[model samples]
Target: MGLLAFKDAVHLVSRTGLGAEWDMIKQLEGRSQEDAVNWVLHSAASGLRPTPRMTPWLKLEPMRLNDMKTRNSAWSISQREGKLLQAWWVEQMLATHTPFIERMTLFWHNHFTSSIQKTLQPSLLYQQNLLLRRHATGNFAELLRAMARDPAMLVYLDGYQNTKSQPNENFARELLELFTIGRGQYRESDVKAAAKAFTGWGVDNNTGKFIIRPEEHASDSVTFLGKTGRFTGDDIIKILLEHPRTAERLTEKFWLEFVSNRPDPALVSVWAQQLRKSHYDIQRFMRTLLTSEPFWALQNRGTLVKSPVELVIGTLRTLPYPRESTQELLNLCRLLGQELFDPPNVKGWSGGEHWISTQTLLVRNAYLSKLSRGDLNDKSAAGVKLPNASEEQLVEWLLPVKPLQPLPTTPGARRLVRSLLLDPAFQVS
Candidate 1:
């Protein structure tokens, strides 16, 4: 509850928002933790870039379903539009005043786990992106409910094909294992029951909206999580929300995301209880998390590996360097193992140490080295103006921990920053 020092403010902003954005950290530096956290929770701009034009699902669907040649053409169109969609989001992240919203939207996009590649419909994915943003920090229960019928997700997980006679368990299985509870909490039978509950939930071919084909729905009673009822998809979601593990699983994910890769079990329990008590209110949960003791712990600093989006977008936002073009940014994201709207699998990006394999580290270093080139030389031909700060202040601004590699023996501001940028520590928060 005391005023946050510069280091603490930097930690809060860097971990919660995009990067260690100087102005944001400075704004929160002398404020109470409550005030700073409130500012983060509420201070988001409402504007968004207009979505790029996409072939509507109605037109695109028939092309894919028609024949091999048409399907090949549809695939090519999907590839093109998907890149445009990726560029749209990349542009938003670079230009938005609401970086936290974009960050959380990315977070939920990972959790929900739909992909342009699997769905083959960039237009539907765009709509899914909008849905994720709307409920990014609003309510977990509502978001879960909305995601159940999300057109992209339906296509990605084959929920649209889940008829009463032939239940597809892909979406149901992920809903239990990844979304609601961890794997051990549910039985195979529970997945079957859940799939039955979701039967007849299909997207309309003409309009691409969620449509319930009641005739295809199973009306038989199915037991789920120790309860017996003839359940609908909404009914199944309601039951999952009431399960204790649902909140705990979500809390565990939050701990991994904001606290560290390794969650303290005792703290996870307490936060899970608090989240459940708040009726899954995400902003309230985040307020508790940001104000919690563990969030400010010294040992937790730099324990997280930065994702590709964080590294690319965060660097551009924090530094005075010119940004890569949107297309190149998309390529970096793909090369760095996190192509937007194209997560590797349902598990999404394995983010922790997985973000820093030997190959990716080389790419990361090469990108940073290229970005900082010439800007550090005498006369500074790139004309980038780094903050006028001392070596210690610059270190604090650029790194979450002491530079793993020794600082440069030479004495220049840009040189010091370039050294910190290449340090192993910069790959982390």
Candidate 2:
């Protein structure tokens, strides 16, 4: 266990918050652990300010079902939305005083993975981003139900076009296989039956809402897991939520995603018990995980490889850089393998050690150099300077990592700067 002091508390805060700066940590100095924890909780909640969403300049404002076969330029629209999505996340990471909420937002983002690359429409992807962020700290049941009907999810999972006669097993398969249950927990027969039960469950053309036509549904009562009944999608979700496997599966996921890839059985089991006790109260579960004795175990620190979004957003937040031009910055994020809301596949990014590579390291170096130098230059360029970036120097910006100092500069100061630019700890946030 780590020392429960202002310094240790600050380390905990950095892990939970948007990889916060030491100045913020110093400001939080001398407070009780409860006070610090409450500070983050209260701060995250208060920071969420509702902003009006911008309507995209859609050339095909009213899309036709007939043109679905020959859709084009939707790609551009999706990319445009991608740009806005990054800006919004950067804004959230920078402005939010609390780290738990942002951490939760990232947790939810990976859990409910829908890529705009597949969706082909920014409007739907953008809507889902807000949905995850807004409900990041809310009830899990409500969020799950809402996401089941969300357009982005529907399209990404092929749930939108599901029909009775020709049922799409895509959504039902993933519903149990990926989202709720880990692999092999549910039998193949269960997936087939679930797909049949989910037949005709789809969204409408104009207004994106759940609509199940009675004729379209496979009304034949099917047996799922030895239970015979007419199971709708909602019923399936309810049953899944009730399953012991769901809790265990989610527990494993929480361990891998938040605490450590190599989980401590005692800690995870305790968390599972507490999560069940709280009736799936996510906020409570997170609090349990974040502040636990095992959580601050020295081995667990820096164990998680930062996701692309974590690295980019966390850096931007630490510097609190001015966003004069976002196009290039977003493009750089794309180079780093995290184009906002655009995962490589339904399974999402593999994430652990895959985040590091020679090429990606170079890209990371270039990005940090951009931050340290305040360069917005390109082949054909216009420079943008951030006023605050000057005051928030590089070494201080790096305090979230241990050592509280830059890498050794004795060999070569310039090379030290370069290594600092590409440091492995920069990957974690």
Candidate 3:
């Protein structure tokens, strides 16, 4: 309950933020855990960079049906604009003062998964990014309601095609299985009921906003989770929120993300209860997770693998080396299998051990090796100067665990730092 130790400070920063930023870790090193967690919860980066220019949905939607040439043209335009959008976010991550906000925004983007590949409208994907960031640390209940109305989500999950005559269960199925309550907790009838409730929710082509056509809505009463009513989409969401498994499912995800890959059922239940008690407040739940004993347990350190963005973006943020160009970073993300705006599928990245496949580990090491080479040899260099700290401090700073390979028997802080950067330990948190 006293001031945090240096290692604990590093653990908190690395897990919550992009990386263990030296100055950030130093600021919290002597502060109490409560104070440190509060600082992280409150300090979010303000104002995103201006969005990259994108072709509107109306202009692009017609091209797909017009002719083969126009359809090809549309694909080319989307490909171009999508790369620009990816670069825009990479730039922000590189320069942001508050990395924690960006990290959380990325977290929710995965949670409410939508992709440029499926949407084909970079502009709408951009809008969805904004919505996620707005509620990144706010109430989950509000976020779920808003996401049901989100234009990008409407397209990605075929919610716009849902109608009274023929209901599409794509969105409703994922909403129950992946987003809330998880699998096996809900029945197929619940999926059908939820889909019926969401019918007539579509996007306005002209202005790119949500629209509801009353004629397309189902008026028939349906029973959902033992409740019979002619329910609307919002009503369905409300019923789900009332379900006990909703908060607990979310807690399991947070555990896998922040703690170890394996979530302890007992702790997850307690955290979920606390989360529900707080009315699904995200910041309140994070404060609990960060301060919990399991989070600070030594055995849990470095148990989770770092995602591509964390490995690539985080290293540049923490080290003195010059960052790769935004395009290059985007390529690295794709190769590492964490493409920013284009998640592989609805489930998003598997993360954890999935981040460190044999091929990916090679790419990861090569990137660190190249980064460390720049100005690592000379402490007096004008660019990329290694920090003038003891070998022990450098090891403590760079890795959450002991170096997998032996430390350099030769004595130089720069040499030791380079060795630690490529260490297997560095691959984890």
Candidate 4:
């Protein structure tokens, strides 16, 4: 790869991973291609963080609405779930030295967006996140199936209520249109057929468990994708995962999210071919693309924008903000359109360019400015231990990049902090 191209590659990894900490970028500064690839994969030991404990129940339980207690309970549960999701993501953001694994996990979350609003349980969302993290770098065929029958998913997509007499087509339609083959790749008739096959596929009411009631399931034969037979939702998923269109759509989505925002059709084809050939080994697929010539191209670097979570968590990690200063930072996240488990919609936040709007940009500046105002101290104990970065001996620690030519006293320090926050480089990796 060319020099600038490699720099761009580093940038891509940084932007896609957690925003680059100097130590990580330095390690890959002059490394060989293979070394860089190995380094990223081995960056974390599964790197998954503990689930957050905040739930809708916790948030609303204090209110204790006599009549709407269920509603309050649900909200509290969602808040905890939301906190768990955010905490989990933030841990990955801070701890994982590699960029691609985190990037892939972020991609999968969007592709299979699940809402605690519908699932009504933090456990469900936690379980789903676990599935995404575990299979994120694995086979798509298996990944797709696991997501389809997920208890959380069953409730989120209304698949659990599907019955033979009145089959709900929501799951079938989204499965084909959004999740797999996508629109125009399959026909309306196929969706209808798929829905029929999935009837009586739902979760249990009493224990809130997965229940595949055979009697409620449609018994009649159905035609899907030119094949006529008694196919269930599982069969439809199996068929779809095996379709060429599935490979095409999945590759396109992955490329746009990870490799490039402006995905070249040819580049996507390259990945799709590899994916199909490898039976959709996720990490292998990512590894292939990361090592590809087109992926390291200069045009792909710094061209894409960072999302809210990325911007917030990235700044937090690189700056190594004190742990005591974590709460307000979370509040900033809420203001920036990406509130952890609470994605704006089923589609999730349409990140990319939207993450850096006027309002959110202002908030970002404010966040950094506040960091300058605090002293890195331990509140509980006298002459307590400092945060991770107390010594200012290192060049990076001593030198906070500032815009003004000559750094000043108090005012200058604040301006320096503001400038660091405003630096375009801070906006990305």
The lDDT leader among the candidates is 1
Could you tell which candidate, 2 or 3, scores higher by TM-score? 3
Runs in model 2 with CA error above 4 Å?
1-6, 44-64, 67-70, 320-324, 374-422
Q: In candidate 1, which residue pairs get closer than 3 Å at backbone N, Cα or C atoms, i.e. clash?
A: none
- Cα lDDT listed for each candidate: 0.91, 0.67, 0.89, 0.67
**Per-model root-mean-square deviation over C-alphas:** 1.1, 5.2, 1.2, 5.8
TM-score of 4: 0.81
Determine which window of 10 residues in candidate 3 has minimal summed lDDT: 374-383
lDDT computed for candidate 2: 0.67
Cα lDDT of model 3 by residue, 28-133, tens digit: 9999999999999998467788879999988987887688999999889888999999999998888888888898889888889999888888888899889988
**Per-residue lDDT of 1-429 in model 4, one digit per residue for the tens?**
533223443454464466655556556767776667666765664555654654432344334335687667666666666665666666666666555666677778888877766666666777777788777777788988888878778878889878888888888898898888888888888988999998887766555556789999887998899888889778888788778888888888777665667777876777787788888888787777777775666556555566766666665555555543345556778898776555666667777778878988888767666654544232333322223432222213222222323333443333344444556645543
Better of 3 and 4 by lDDT: 3
TM-score of each prediction = 0.98, 0.83, 0.98, 0.81
Backbone N/Cα/C clashes per model: 0, 1, 0, 17
Lowest-lDDT window of 10 residues in candidate 2? 378-387
Q: Write the per-residue lDDT of candidate 2 for residues 1-429, one digit (tens) a residue.
A: 323454456466667766645566666667666666666665636455454254342433344223653354455555666667667766666567666777777777777889867766566777887788778866676787788878788888988677777888888888887778667777888887888887777766555555776778887888776677988878887787777666677788777876677877766677776676677777677667767766666667667777666666666665444443556656776788866677777777767778889998888777776665532232222332222332234433453355434566354323343445466565663
Cα displacement (angstroms), candidate 2, residue 81, comes to 3.9
> Taking the tens digit of each residue's C-alpha lDDT, what string does model 1 give over 1-429?
599988889898999877888888889999999999999999956699987999999999999898899999999999999999999999899888878999899999999998888899999999999999999999999999999989999999999999999999999999999999878888999999999999999999899999999998999999998899999999999988888899998998888899988888888888888888888999999998988888888999999999999999999988888777889988998999999999999989888888888899999999999998774556464648777778898898889899999998978887888899999999998
lDDT of 3 at 259: 86
Error of 3 at 413 (Å): 2.2
